[model samples]
Target: MADLVVGVGLRDGVGAAAVVTAVRSAIAEIDASPTDVVALATLDRKAAELAVVRAAAELGVPVLGFTAAELAAASVPNPSARVAAVVGTPSVAEAAAILGSGGGELVARKRARDGVTVALARTV
Candidate 1:
């Protein structure tokens, strides 16, 4: 089985439950088991966010953090101009997952819930 990476995007003060929900939702959307996930990824700025940290710990994986510029360098199937205006990137979850997976294929598109967003990519 190919290893998968889950990339996260969240607003400030998000709860761990919400993060968990988003991750589960995204992975489920792609019909992948939790064991397929190797790690979680997100903006370096939010790497230390308790929600993300807690969610990664809960998922039994380390969190890989990437800078906004690094995330912006990636090309995503779905890019949001509004997200770019806010965080200087067209996408956070999709790009982070792509970059974290070594430019791998996006297995799942972005999904939002309870103030969090998640996407999945297969490791190259």
Candidate 2:
């Protein structure tokens, strides 16, 4: 099986419960387990997000933060103008996942729930 990377985005005040729920949903779509995940990625501004940190700790993976420019440079299937206006990135979860995977193929697009978003990618 291919190694996977998961990228996450969450609204402020989101908790680990919501993050875990969203991540589980995304990985389930690709039949991946926590053990299959190599890392988690998100915007650098959110490096201190407790939800992201907790999720990474729970899954036993490191969390990587990407700059807005790096995330914006990634090609994502779901670009959002609203996100661009707020974070200077069109697609946080998808872009972070793609970039964090080092040009890996996106296996799951953004999956959102309870103010949390998740996407998965696999290195090719």
Clash totals, every prediction: 0, 0
Please provide, for model 2 over 1-124, each residue's C-alpha lDDT reduced to its tens digit, 9 standing for 90 to 100. 4588888888999998888888878887777777788988999989678888898898888899999999999989999999999889898999989988998999998988999888899966
Tell me, by lDDT, which candidate is best.
Answer: 1
What does candidate 2 score on TM? 0.95
Q: What is the C-alpha lDDT of each candidate?
A: 0.90, 0.88
Task: Judge candidate 2 at residue 19 and give its lDDT.
Answer: 88
Q: Which regions in candidate 2 have their CA more than 4 angstroms from the true location? A: none
- Return the lDDT, model 2, position 103: 89
In candidate 2, residue 41 scores what lDDT?
Answer: 93
Question: For model 1, where is the 10-residue window of minimal lDDT?
Answer: 24-33
Q: Which window of 10 residues has the lowest lDDT sum in candidate 2?
A: 26-35
